[model samples]
Target chain A: MKVSAIITLKKDVLDPQGKVIHQALDGMGFENINEVRQGKYFEIDVNENDPSKAKAIVEDMCKKLLANLVIENFKIIGTQ
Target chain B: MKSSVITFPGSNCDRDMDVALKKFGFNNKMVWHDDNELPKSDLVVLPGGFSYGDYLRCGSMASKSRIMQSVIDFAKSGGLIMGICNGFQILVETGLVPGVLLRNKYLEFICKNVFVKLDNKENAYFKNINKDILEFHIAHNEGNYFCTKDQLKEIEDNNQIAIYYCNSEGKIQDQYNPNGSIKNIAGIFNKKKNVLGMMPHPERMIDQSLSGEDGSIFFKNLINNIK
Candidate 1:
């Protein structure tokens, strides 16, 4: 089974990289932007055949290593 | 005094820390990140470097290295452990310290000397230090510090702030903050004051002619504190 997860900075945390990207986009003439936030995506293939088990395993990984709870949040987006 | 400096893969400042420790009359050992056991020592250091190439966040990969278990145990047992720069990032990852280091506000890798004003002097690291302000070198892209409002309250209540970026005259202002750290926090300690995590590189300032002697004073005072 394979699972995908995305990590994003928490709402209250500042994202300077995202801000810079927004600035670059603005400079390129993409004007109507309220905000731009960046995040990370990861796909992991587990040995488990059950999709639910694989998702759980990846969720544990997210809690432990994939995301820092202090400033970032992680979500298991999909399992296949 | 006896000390140990852990050398994670890509840790560039481990040797410099070793030299600084030994120069200040400490019998320092170089410990590998993969090693499961730590040699007996009075102090342990997590030096600065691009551990694991700063993938998935600075110090995140290195914090999970095999040796960190031992380092965490040491810290829990009230042993003195200091994390400098990337080490500070690792320390926060281990939950031994509070707060997180984020990308610099300007989105740039800052490398320069800045003055840091000591906050609390009741701890072993700065208890007997003569000066309140010292110049140290900071070099990193993700050195800005952040924490939840509740964590900030707890940290302040416990007096865990170690140092603040400041002017030479010891004035801590937003303009003096080098990396946009929260309240200009350059370093902090655990509630017990044994574990210290700071973004500045004291080892880089150990020599007067080459750099400055503030690091030398820091090491000298640290050794005496341990002894």
Candidate 2:
């Protein structure tokens, strides 16, 4: 099974990189950009074939490595 | 005292910290990030550098190193831990310290000797140190510390605010709050008060005439109290 984890900073936290990107977009004459936030996406290939087990494993991985629970959130998506 | 300083691949301040510890009569060892076990240490110091090249974010990658697992365990066992500069960022990334470090408000790297006021005297790291202004060097781009308003309140109420940026006159003014850190916090102690992380480098200022030497009191206090 292949899983994807989308990790983003928690809503309440400030995203300086995102803010810089937003300013850059404005400088390029791009409009309609209400807000800009940055995140990371990780794709992992798991050996398990069961959907439930894969989900659990990926969630564990997110908590352990992919996401910092103190300041970030992560969601897992996959097909088994 | 038995102490060890963890050195990531890019760590440049490990020697400075080691020298400071040795000057304070500590038998210090340098533990690499790849090692799974920390030296039997009463105090563990994480020296500053661009760990893992600050990949993904400052201190983000280094927090996942093999050594941090042991550091976390050591911290859980009530061992004293101190992170300076990049070390501070790693502490937050590893969740050993609370809050996050964002880029400097000016969007540029800052390196200079700044005044820091010792706020918490009860901590072992600050024991016997009078509440006064100490000069230390800070060199980093991502050093702005942030947390929620309620979290700040809790930290204040718990007496975890360890250090604050101050001026030559020893006044903690909003303008002197380097990097726009919330509550002007320059350093903080964990809930247990055994772990401490700060942006200023005490190791860089151990000699009074050279680096103002006032910073030596921090190490002297640690050596005297941690035993």
Candidate 3:
């Protein structure tokens, strides 16, 4: 089974990289953007046959290593 | 005093720390990151460097290395463990300490000497220390520390803050903060106070001709405390 997850900075956490990118976009004439936030995406293929079980394993991975709970939140997008 | 410095794959400051430890009367040993057993020692150090190439996050991968279990055990047993620079990052990743090191606010690497004021000296790392402020070398891109409000309150309640960025005269002001760390924290200690994590590299400031001698005051005090 394959699972996908996205890790994003918490709402209150500062995203300096996103801010820099937003500034660059503004300079390139892509104005009207209210905000920009940076995140990470990961796809993992587990040996488990069940989709739910695979997603659960990936979620565990997210909680342990993929994302830092202090500043990041992880979401499981889907399992295939 | 006996000391060990764990050298991760990309740890550039391991040798420097070893030299500093030996200079201060510590019989230091270099321990590889893959080694499972930590030699008997009075102090253990995780030196500053770009460990594991900072691939996933600063100190994230190195925190999960094979040798960490022993390190954790040693810390759990109340042995002194100090993490400087990237080592501080690893300490947070391992949950041995509170908070995380975020990217620099200006998105630039900061490499220079900065003064740090001791916040609490009750811990083993700084008990009865000679100086209130020390000039130390700080070189890191992601040394800006952050934490949740609840954690901050708890850490404050426990007096876990170790040091703060300050001026040469020991003034704790925002203008002295090199990075946007919460509360201008430059170093912190675990609840037990046996484990310490700090962004500044004391080893880089040990020699007078090379940099400064404040690190000597720190190490000399630390060894005496343990003895």
Best by TM-score: 1
| TM-score of each prediction | 0.99, 0.90, 0.98
Q: Interface Cα RMSD per model, in Å? A: 0.6, 2.4, 0.5
User: In candidate 3, what are the lDDT values of residues B1-227, reduced to their tens digit?
Assistant: 89999999999999999998998899999999999999999999999999999988899999999989999999999999999999999999999999999998889899999999998988888888988999999999999999999999999999999999999999988898888999999999999999999999999888889899999999998988988
Native contacts retained by model 2, as a fraction?
0.29
Give lDDT: candidate 1, residue B137: 95
Candidate 3's C-alpha runs over 4 A off are: none
Better model by lDDT, 2 or 3?
3
Candidate 1 error regions (>4 Å): none
DockQ-derived CAPRI band for the predicted complex in model 3: high
Where's the lowest-lDDT run of ten residues in candidate 1 chain A? A71-80
How well is each residue in B127-165 modelled by candidate 2, as lDDT tens digits? 777647788899989888887777788888899988999
* Model 3: colliding residue pairs: none
Error of 1 at A29 (Å): 1.5
lDDT of 3: 0.94
> Could you give candidate 3's per-residue lDDT for residues A1-22 as a string of tens digits?
8899999999989999999999
